[model samples]
Target: MSVFMVERDLKGISMDDLAGAQKAAIKTAAQMSDKGDKISYIRSTFAPEDGRCMCLFDGESAEQVQRLNDEAGLPYNRVVTALDLTP
Candidate 1:
């Protein structure tokens, strides 16, 4: 599986909405897994000061990550393959 970074621009998003989005992501990812589509939500980072959010997912491909977000009805700007650099 490839890791992906999903970006979203949601200005003035409330905490409640963010919580809901996380919930949706988890549910959708689990459903996808049940259907034999390997997708896992790693975590999320939010820069509320800039109204930007980034979600990390490990999946088959970037397209799968995009589909996962779409199925969750989460508004996102883009999904790109992510490479981890650990020292």
Candidate 2:
């Protein structure tokens, strides 16, 4: 699976809501995977100062990642193919 980054603008969002969004992403990814879709929520980075959030996921394609976010009701500016160079 390739990694994809979902960029979101969440200005003025509360911490609780941010956490909730994360949970929703995870839950939705799991549900999709259970249904035979090869997708998983990897992690997220949120810059509270700018309300910019980037979520990472492992999936078969960018379209799959987009669908996951859409089903989770998560708002994203864009979804793009990304390289996860975590050593």
lDDT of each: 0.91, 0.95
Give the range where candidate 2 is weakest over 10 consecutive residues by summed lDDT. Answer: 62-71
Which tens-of-lDDT digit does each residue in 1-87 have in candidate 2? 899999999999999999999999999999999999999999999999999999999999999998998899999999999999889
What is candidate 1's lDDT per residue for 4-65, written digit by digit as tens?
99999978999999999999999999999999998999889999999899899989998889
What's model 2's TM-score? 0.97
Best by lDDT: 2
Give per-residue lDDT, candidate 2, residue 20. 99
Return the clash pairs for model 1, or none.
none
